[model samples]
Target: MATILSIIPYHFYPPVGGGALRCYNILKEMARDHTVYVVTSQPEDTFTSDEDYTLPERVVIISISKMLLHISGSSACKKVFNAISYRVKKRTLKGPANSFFLASYSAIISLLKDVKFDVIYYESLESVGELSGPIRRFSISFTHIYDAHNVDSILWAQQAKALQNERLMNYANNALQLEKKLFKCIDTFFCCSYEDREKLIRLNELKISGIVVPNGVDISKKPYDDDAFKYSRKNIIFCGSLNYQPNIEGLLWFYTAVLPALKSAIPGLVLTVVGQNASYDHYKALMEDESVNFVGTVPDVNPYYYSASVAIVPLLSGSGTRLKILEAMSLGNPLVTTTVGAEGIRYEDGKHLLIADKPQAFVEQILTLLTDKQKFDTIRQNAQKLVMEIYDWQVIGKSISTQIPVLLKEKYGGR
Candidate 1:
């Protein structure tokens, strides 16, 4: 088995998000066969000490302090600035302002100075430029696989437009430039979706070796009880990290356009929004209407999934495959999402999922699903079948594993 070093800004365990979840699942699978070392940032929770954050057996976890690296900023700004500075300096600005950058840079240094590995799996090239100098220094023989979890720069640009944030727009523009420069340094790249891969190819004009390994759900873990599946309740659930722009935007759209229509069609139609890092103002605004409920940061999301009659994804702008969609599908819930929201997943309109673009269309789709139990059941079964056969973590993990040997062979000559 090849030794693999993965550098992600965040780790799998604490303070879960989609990227963290994906990273955790993939690393766990990879660890089954390979010696995996992960360097990620540690969350600042008073309850959880350093000793509490443990890695899996045979898996190494390096936790970097965010305070030392100066990784403080609004989420969008943080990613863009990190991407740009990393591209130019190859070392992050030192201090509390950019700790994530410092953490990542330090981790790469530690890997080069302390450990030996066969392949370097770098997730999200947006901030990877920070390692360019160090990467060049150690660039002689190791295989480098750049994993683009999302077309981050594109998402930044889209968010900037929606929020009318000029600083973010400028950052997004600069990040795109940095992304192009960074792409050429990697030996191979992997994207989470076909749309992301295509955007990387078209925008960067780089024909680098890459594959689409879509995000997946852990199907082996038995789902929550069918009794928890409250088909009798007229409840619609939208789940995601509430702090994320795309999710926030999607929820706002649902609250503004779709919720009213659904309530009109089926009175007392309860809407549940569940996620972490939700601000008081955000929750307040959402809960202004008595029908909407904000359930902040649940330990287990299964109950939320089970309680829903339908799962809604009303994303206006974003890139990459959505884990929320996969999770909803894997749970056998009927989904009503916009075309953009369901961009990367292999689903056909009116088949495995119901895709609607306009607000009115979304409302109609939700109403249709709510009213017709037969059609809802059919879509739910189809979604579950699709996820089982195609989007299971085991299948997707193995696809990623198949590439590891090829990368190793290319670097070590069939070692």
Candidate 2:
């Protein structure tokens, strides 16, 4: 088995998100067959504690300092000073830039100074530039594989179009340029959706070969319990990492457009919004409606999934596949989602999930699902079957593993 060194900004076990969970799950599975070493950033609290990381025997955790040298919204003078410091001392850039540069720098230096690994698996393009300096040193040869979780450029561009704020739009435009430049430097790229892959091919005008390793569901967790499945309330659920702009916008849109229509059609139609780091302003605004319940950051989301009559994804802007959709499908919840929200998932318009882009269509679908038990049950069963056959982590993990040997052969020249 090849010695694999994986670098991610975050991992599983604590302070979780979809990206972190996906990274952890893939690395955990990879560790079972190979000698795996993971280099990641840790929470400041964990740095001082002697808590054992929940990882495989072959996995290694390298913790880095989370010190912020300069706050993100600093003045122009502060920005210039920090940029000089970062350039000269190789210190990290502030905010979102910090995790990418600092973690990669620390990991590359640590690997060069101490540990030896056959391959370097970078989870995203955030730190691809860091590898350039190390690659120039001829003695240490390691293959690089990049997992582009999403087509970040497309995501930024979409955000730029949606945002009214000029400063945010300009930032998003700059981010898109950086992402495009970064994609050209990687050896291999993995994306979550074919749409994203196609976008890259069109944008770069290159026949860049990559695989669509879509996000998956860990069926073992079994998100919905028996009691939740039997809940009588006609509930509609939207679950996601609320801090994400797309998710926040989706939830806000649902409340503003669809919720009133659904309430008017079916009296006492409950809408439960479940997620972490949900904005207090958003929560308070929704709470004023009386029908909306904002459940912030539950330990387990399965119960909420089960309790819902139908899961809704009203995403307006996002680049990749929705893991939440996969999770809801795995849990056997009948779903109503926008065409954009349901992108990349293999599902029929009315079979596995009800697809509706407009607010009126969304409300109509929800009303139909609420009233028609047979249709709801049929879609639920079909979604669950699809999850079992195709979208499960076990199946996805094997496909991801298959690529490793091919990558190894291309890099090392031997089986």
Candidate 3:
């Protein structure tokens, strides 16, 4: 078994978003056949506490801050200086930059001493810079595998378009440049979708094809149920990390444009918004609306999935496949999403889910789905079948685990 070093920016203790879910599953798979060592960050609250996580026995987790606190404060000061220096040096260049020089990474630098790893897995381009200190400290030949969560440049650019912000556009451009530079050191690229893979190839003009490892659902978590298609009070469900800029923007757009029209048509229409970190005050008017119910973060979203008549993803801009869609579909929840919402997933528009871009078009589709029994049932079944066949976490994880050994052999002559 290979001794792999995986670096991630956040803790996967309570896997929440797409990125976290992917990281958690990949590590879980890797630990099955490898001695996986993880370098990750925790909330400042966990800085002094010994917290037990849901990790396999083969996995060894080391907090970047946990190691840093053992070192003098001067090391952190130097890290800050380095970050500022690097920013100033790159000021002439226009592109997105990774958050590598964070003080936590500086702390991580002190912890790589005398450790050995056959391969290094970079969770995202953002964590690419953490390798510099480790590489400089230990001169070893190890394979570098980059797991591209999203074409972050395109994602940022989409956000720019959605919000119409020039500053975000500039940040997106810079992010593209930084990612391009980072890819130069990557031996293999594990992309989330073919769309993202093609973007990488076009942007970098690469000779080799990327490995597609799409985000997926843990099917074993809950049993599949077909009751998600039941036509009740036309209760609409929207689930995601509400604090995320794209989700926030999409939710606001739906609240303003689509909900009003739907409510007018069906007097008893109900919209259930479920997820965490939502700044409720930002949408005070929407919150006060009698029909709209915000069920802030819950332990299990399965109950909501089973309760709602239809699930909606009115996303205007984002990158990567929607985990919410996969989770909803796994429960046989009928979906109504925009083209951007269904970007990475391979789904037939009318069969798996309904796709409508315009406000009026989206409202029309929602109304039709609520009123039409046959169409909704067909979509619910098709979506469930698709996810069961293609997006199961067990399958996706095993695929990555099997391929990594081959990649290691190809890159460094052995696994």
Per-candidate TM vs. native?
0.86, 0.86, 0.86
Q: RMSDs, each prediction?
A: 5.1, 4.0, 4.2
lDDT (Cα) of model 1: 0.76
Instruction: List the candidate 2 regions with Cα displacement exceeding 4 Å.
Output: 43-53, 66-107, 136-140, 182-184, 223-232
Q: For model 2, name the residue pairs that clash.
A: 223-302
> lDDT per model, in order?
0.76, 0.73, 0.77
Per-residue accuracy of model 1 over 284-315 as CA lDDT, tens digit each: 77867678877878877887888788898899
**What value of lDDT does candidate 3 attain over all alpha carbons?**
0.77
Candidate 3: which pairs clash?
Answer: 95-173, 95-174, 95-175, 96-174, 96-175
Expressed as tens digits, the lDDT of each residue in 1-415 for candidate 3 is 7888788777666576667878888888889888898777654454332232266788777766554443323576765655564455344233232343343454444545556677778886766643533453454577777888888888889878877999989878877886666555666678877888888877767754588988888877745665543865468899999878889899999999898999998988899999988786656776788898888788789888778888999998877788999998888678999999998898999999999999999999888888888888888889888988899987887887788789878877784
Ranking by lDDT: 3, 1, 2
- Give candidate 1 misplaced runs (Cα > 4 Å): 43-55, 66-110, 222-231
TM-score of 2: 0.86
